[model samples]
Every structure is written in C-alpha cells, then in structure tokens.
Target: MDTITLWELVALAGAATLVGFSKTAVSGANTVSLAIFAAVLPARESTGILLPLLIVGDMFAVRAYRRHADWATLVRLFPAVAAGVVAGTVFMLWADDAAVRTSIGVILLVMASITVWRRRTAGQQAREQKGQGEEEGRGEPAGEGRQRARLKAGSYGVLGGFTTMVANAGGPVMSMYLLSAGFRKLGFLGTSAWFFLIVNVAKVPFSVGLGLIDRHSLLLDAGLALCVVPGAFLGRAVVDRINQRLFERLVIAATVVGGLQLLLR
Candidate 1:
C-alpha cells in the first residue's frame, strides 16, 4: 500500500466512492472506477482490490432495494453466467493484461451499441402501443416477447459473467440487460445489487486461488471502503431525482466512455 503515491490514493478513493454511487444509483458508472483502479494498480491486482469495495457498496444497495429484486430473472441468468465465468477463469490463466483490457473494451463497445439500438426499438414499441390505445401486446406477440426475453437473458448473462470475471466490468452489460427488460429504477437497482453480491462473493475463492486477492489487496480495500459510505448516501439521495430517460442516457454515456478509455489506454 505504501508503494502508491498520494495522488494515486486520492484517485482510488474517488473511484471507490463512485463504486458505491454506481451500485445504488448510476449502475454502470463504476466502469470509471475500474479504469481508475487499473490505472493506479497492476491491472490484475486492481480487480482484486476493487472486488471487496464493490461488495461493500452492493450491501448498501441490497439493503436499500432488496424487496424489488426479480428472482425469476436471476434464475434464468445464473446458468449462462456460470458458464461464462468458467470460460473467463480459463482465459485468465493464459491471457495478459493488454489482452483482457482490449477484449473487455470491445465487448463493452458492442454491448453499448446494442443497448442504444434496443432503446430505439423500445421507444418505437412504446409509440406503437400508444397509437393502439395502450392495448397490451397489440403490436407484438406474447410468445415473441418471451422468446426475445430468453435470448436477452442468455446472451447478456454470458457476457456479464465473462466481463465481470475478467475485469469487474460486468455492470455495464447488466445495466443494458435490465434496461432492455423494462425494469424501472428500483427493480434495476435491486436486481443488480443482489446479482453482483452473489456473483462477487462466488468469485472470492477463485480470486484467492489466482493470487489476485492477498493481504496487500485487503489492506488497500479497507482504506478505499471508507470512501464508499458517503458515495452510497449521495447515490440514494439522487437516484429518485433523476428521471428514467436521463438515467439510462447517463449510464450509456458513461459506459461508452469507459470502454473507449480501456481500449485506448
């Protein structure tokens, strides 16, 4: 921990705060924190250090929105996500830092594009529904909707698992999934909080085995965790004030920028 400069500590503290804020309010905004950690520490070690802080933030989010979770969605996603995590673990055994960064960056950009496209489609569907006087399923068949939902869950689950495993970059992918699923603010926050908590905890053994989380990382995490509390409170305070459309836009914008930074850096 003493190896880092004072400026680096300040950046990490700010990043930790953003982690808490993202967990509760912004959702995908922690990609900024990822970039900061990676910049400040070894890329691989940064992921380990960030994980505990993320869990701390996740606890705050879960407490705030536990009742709003969608268990059915989680059930559908877990298998695919697990498969992806296994794949990521295997990849990490051989991949270097640059490879991980570039791959995650590409994935993020692709997911961001898909999210924008989906938002446009959703807007179109809403307009069509309005034109049809809000009759449910007037424009789309229930079966088709179900099929699309299943596909979304499967694809995003895999991507989210893989990204999170490799780089702690799954939040953006999951954010896109929840937004496309038509989750309102509370449901999105609750489901995301729970999903990450379970998944991050699951990764602990793997991280330990991989030597990513060690005594040094834990010491660093303890310091960073302090910054998360105020950030969590700030997130809780501001989440409701931001409207849905604005929230989605801000998340997407931050995701795009994070991806680009990872790629370019």
Candidate 2:
C-alpha cells in the first residue's frame, strides 16, 4: 500500500467508486475499473484487490434488489458457472499474464459482437412482424424457447464464470445474457445482483487457494473499499431516472469499451 503512488491511489479510489456505481446503476461500467486496476497494480494481483471491492458492491446491490432475483435462472446457471470457475482456476495456474489478458480480451470482443448481432436480428424480426400485422407467431415455439434458453444459460454461465474467475470481466458477458433474456431495469439489477453476489462469494475459497487473497491484499482493499460506498449511493440516486432504452445502450457501450481496452492493453 505504501508503495503505491498518490496518483495510483487516487485512480484506484476512483475505480473503487465506479465499482459501487456499476453494481447499482450500470452493471458493465466496472470494466473500466478492472482495466484501471490492472494497469496500476500487477495484473494478477489486481484481480485480488478488485475482488473484495466487488463483493462490497455486491452486498449493496443485493440489499437493494434482493426481491427481484430470478432464482430459477440462477439455479440453471450455477452448475455451469461452478464448472467454469474450476476450469478458470486451473487455467489461471497454467497461464501467464499476457495469455490470460489476451484470451479474455478476445472472448469479450466475440461476446459483444454476438450480442450486437442478436439485438439487430431481434429488432428486424420485431419490425417485420409489426409490418406484417402478425402477432400470433411472435413468440417461438415452447420447445424451441426452452432449448434456446438452456443453450444461452449454459453458454453464458460458463463464460461468465471463466472470465470473471480469470480477470473479473464477467459483467459484460452476463449483461449480454440478461439483456438477451429481455430483463428490465429492476429485474436486470436484481438478478445480476444475486448472481454475482453468490458467484463471487463462492469463488472466495478458490481465490484463496490460488493465493489471490492475503493479508496484504486485504489491507489494500480496506484502504480502497470505502470509496465504493459513495459511488453506490450515487448510482442508486440516478438509476431510476435512466430509462430502459438508455440503460441497454449504456450496458452495451460499456461492454464494447471494456472489450477494446482489454484487447489493446
């Protein structure tokens, strides 16, 4: 902690504040925080320092949106996420910093592209349906819907687990999943709040096994975690004012930026 320069400390505090804000208002914006921390600290150690701050943010998010969680969806995702987390831990032990960063960056970009394409396709379909005055066939067949939902939950849950375990970069991926699932503001926040709170907490023992959390890291976190409180409050204050469309756009934009940052950094 003492080795960190003043500017670095300020940057971390700012990023920590964004952590709080991201939890409550914009879910994906903390990719910026992730990038900033990785730049200021050792990439591997950055994940450790950031984890506690995220858990703190998660606590607040859960408290605010606990009732809105989609427990069924969470149930479907947990097993896959657990598998992914284990795979991610193994990968972390095997891969170096560059490999981890580059791989995660590529994954983020690909996920973002897929999400954009899905949104466009869905929009076009909606337009065509409206133009044709065909509302009866708007929803997919029940079987098809179930199949698609399973596919999405499995794919996204695993990826969310892998990326978050490796670099704490799961927010964008999960945002894509939730957005594609057609979650609204409160529901989105609520489900994600519980999803991450549980996933991150479950990751604690593995993180410790990896030596990612320790006394020094905890001390550093204690210094920085307080900033997250104000940011959370600020997010809650303005979140209701943000409309659905704007919220989606913000999430997508942040995801793109986060992917780009990782790829280029």
Candidate 3:
C-alpha cells in the first residue's frame, strides 16, 4: 500500500471522484472506477480500498436524494439480498472465484436484454391502450403485476447481493432492476443510494473477516473520500438537465459495458 507513486495517487483521486458521480448520476458508471482501482493496486486489495470510498459516495447520494426512495422496493429486496450475501461469503472460501464472476457477467447481460424487451413491450402496450380507447383497454391485472414484481425483486436482489459481495459489481444489476420497474430518475437514485449504503455497510464485518478491509485500506480511503465530494456535487448539478430517456440509455449502456468487462476480464 505504501509503494503507490504520486501518479498512482492522482489516478486514484480521479477514480474516487467518479465513485461519487456514479452514485448520484449514472449508477453503473462506477465500473470505470473499479477498472481504475484494479489497474492501480492489486485487484483484491483494490476491492477493500474502494469499498470505503463507495460508502462515502453513498452517504452523499442519500443526503441529496433520500426523500425520493421507494421503501416498498427496498423492503421486497432485503431478504433475498441477505441470502445472496451469505452465499457470497461461502464463495470467498473457494480457491478461485472466476466461475462465479463469469456467471454474474452472463446474468447481467441476460438481465439487460430482458429489461430492453420489457420496455418495448410496455411501450407497445401503452400505444395499443391509447388506440383501443380508455373504455375498451384494461390495465395489467393487479395480482399478475404483483407476482411479477416479487419474482423480479427476488432474482435481482439475490444477484445484486452476490455480485456486490464478490466484486463490488452490484450497482449495474440493481440499476437494471430499478429501470425495469419504471422508477424515475430521482427515485432510482434515491432507492439505490439507501440500498447500497445499507448493504455496503453491512458487508464490512464480512470483509474484515476476509481480511479485505484493514487499517491500511482505511488510511487510503481517508484521502480518496475527499475526491468523491466534488463528483457528487457535479452529478447533482447535472441530473435535472438529463431527460429520463437519456438517463435510462446511459444506465443501460454502462450496464452493458460493465457486464462485458466482467465477462471478458
């Protein structure tokens, strides 16, 4: 940890700032931060170093968008997420985690495809409803809609927990979930902020037991956390200007990029 050069620190500071930007703006964009950190430090050590920085970013995100959170969504996810976290802990006991990472990457790509299909289907349904007129058209059955939501919450929640625990890659997974559920920008950001802040903080004990977080990592985090503040402000300043369509496109694009990186790495 002590051997990082001046240029390396510069790189880390920049990455740290992007951590905050990602938390507030486009959630999946922090895969860039993940890549930067991996390049600068040992991959394993980088995960530990980056976790605290992410928490700092999460704090700022929650403060800015806390009121917009969807509590019902959070409630639906926690149980499944907890189970996945435990599974991830066992995965860490394995000698190699390559298979798990590959599986997550593949799942991410599949989820992205599903989200696209769902959006198109919904748009088509909306158009058909408009053409059919209000009296003839009907909404989705409440029971069916509830069932689908539960299924999605379970699957995405487990995947989100496992990927986050294993690789700090949960953001893209959860972002896809939020987008699929038709959450608007502030709601997406707010729910995500609270979700990750809680999950990441919860992972601390496991990370410590795994020897991934320690005094040295915290020391590095202290310096890097400062960079996140500026990025948070930058994201907040520009978020309102981003129309919903563009925001969703950027989230999906980042999710795909993150998935490809994980798959190809």
Candidate 4:
C-alpha cells in the first residue's frame, strides 16, 4: 500500500461518504468513489480498502429500507450472481490491474448505453400503449413477460456479480436492471440495499483469501467509516426530495464519467 497523503485521505473520506449516500439515496453514484479510490491507491488495493466502508453503508441502507425489498427479484438474481462471482474470481486471479480497470470501464460505458436505449424504447412502448388505451398487461402475453423477466434476472445478475467482484462497480449495472424492472422509489432503494448488503458480505471471504483485506485495510476503513454516518443520515433525510427520473439521469451521467475516467487513466 502507498503512503496516504493529506489530500488522498480527504479524497478517500469523501469517497466513503459517497458510498453511504449511494447506498441510501443514489443507487449508482458510487462509481465516483471507485474512481477516487483507484486514483488514490493501487487499483486492486483500492477495491479492498473500499469494501468495508461499503458494508457499513450497506448496513445503514438495509436498516432504512428493509421493509420495501422485493424478495422475488432477489431470489431470481442469486444463482446467476453466484455464477458471475465465480467467473470474476477466476478472472481476478489471472488479470493485471490495468486489464481490470479497462474492462470495468468498458463494461460501465456499455451498460450505460444499453440502459439509455432501453429507457427510450420503454417510453415509446408506453406512448403506444397509451394511444391504444391499453393497460400495461392488457395485450401482452403473461408467458412473454415471465420469460423477459427471467432473462433480465439472469443477465443482470451475472453482470452485476462479475463487476462487483472485480471492481466494486456493480451498482450502476444493478441500478439499470432495477430501473428497467419498473421499481418505484422506495422499492428500488429497499431492494438495492438488501442486495448489496448480502452480496458484499459474501465477498468478504473472497476478498480476504485474495489478500485484498487485512488489518491495515481494516484500520483505514475504521477511519473512513465515520464519514459514512453523516452521509447515510443525509441521504435518508433528503432522498424523498429527489424524484425518480432525475435520480436515474444523475446515476447514468456519473457512471459514464467514471467509466471514461477509468478507460482514459
């Protein structure tokens, strides 16, 4: 680990706060924290150091939104997520830091594009449905919806698991998945909180075995964890002030910028 400077400490503290805020309030905004951590520490080491703080944030989130979680969605995602975690672990064992960074960046950018495109198409479909005076499921086949939902679960679950295992960058991918599934504000936050808390806790053993988490890393986390308290509180306090569309746009924009930074760096 590199020696932490004053500015780096400040940056890390800010990043930790963002982790908490993203957990409770903005779902995908923690890509900024990932970027900041990568900038301040070695790429792999940064992921290790960030994990504990994220867990702390996750706890806050789970507490705030535990009631609103969609267990059905979680059940659908877990098996595929496990597969992705195994794949990511294999990749991590072989890949260098640069490869990890570049791959995560590309994935983020691509996912963002896909998300934007999906939203546009969904909007068009909504307009057509409105024109026909049809309710959401009036004409669509139930089987088709079920199939699409399953496909979404598998695809996003795998991607989310892999990205999170490799780069702590799964938030945006999962956010995109949840948004496309028509989650409302509380449902989105609650479901996301539980998902990350469970997934991140599961990653601890992997991280330790990979030599990513240690006493030193935990010490660093201890300091930064304090920052998360205020951030989580603020997020809970003000989350209702922000609407869904604005939140989604902000998440998308941040994900894009974070990806570009990683790619260019």
What Cα-based lDDT does every candidate model obtain? 0.80, 0.79, 0.76, 0.81
Which candidate number would show the highest lDDT if scored against the true structure? 4
TM-score of each: 0.85, 0.83, 0.79, 0.86
Give the winner by TM-score.
4
**Model 1, 1-265: lDDT tens per residue?**
7789999999999999999988888775687788778767767677788989999999999999898788888898998899878888888888787887777667667767866786687676555445443221112323457778788789999988988888888876887677656565566777888999999999888888888899989988888899999999999998868676776787678667877887899
Candidate 4 segments exceeding 4 Å error? 118-145, 243-254
True lDDT of residue 118, candidate 3: 56
> Count of backbone clashes for each model?
0, 0, 0, 0
Candidate 1 stretches greater than 4 Å from native: 111-115, 118-122, 125-141, 145-148, 243-261
Q: Which is better, 1 or 3, measured by TM-score?
A: 1
**TM-score, cand. 1 vs. native:** 0.85
- Give the local distance difference test score of model 3: 0.76
Candidate 3, backbone clash total: 0
Indicate the TM-score of model 4: 0.86
Say what the RMSD of model 4 is. 3.8
lDDT of 1: 0.80
lDDT of 2 at 73: 78
**Can you tell me which runs of candidate 2 are displaced by over 4 Å?**
107-143, 243-265
Alpha-carbon RMSD, each predicted model = 3.7, 4.5, 5.1, 3.8
TM-score of 2: 0.83
Q: How far is 137's C-alpha from truth in model 1 (Å)?
A: 18
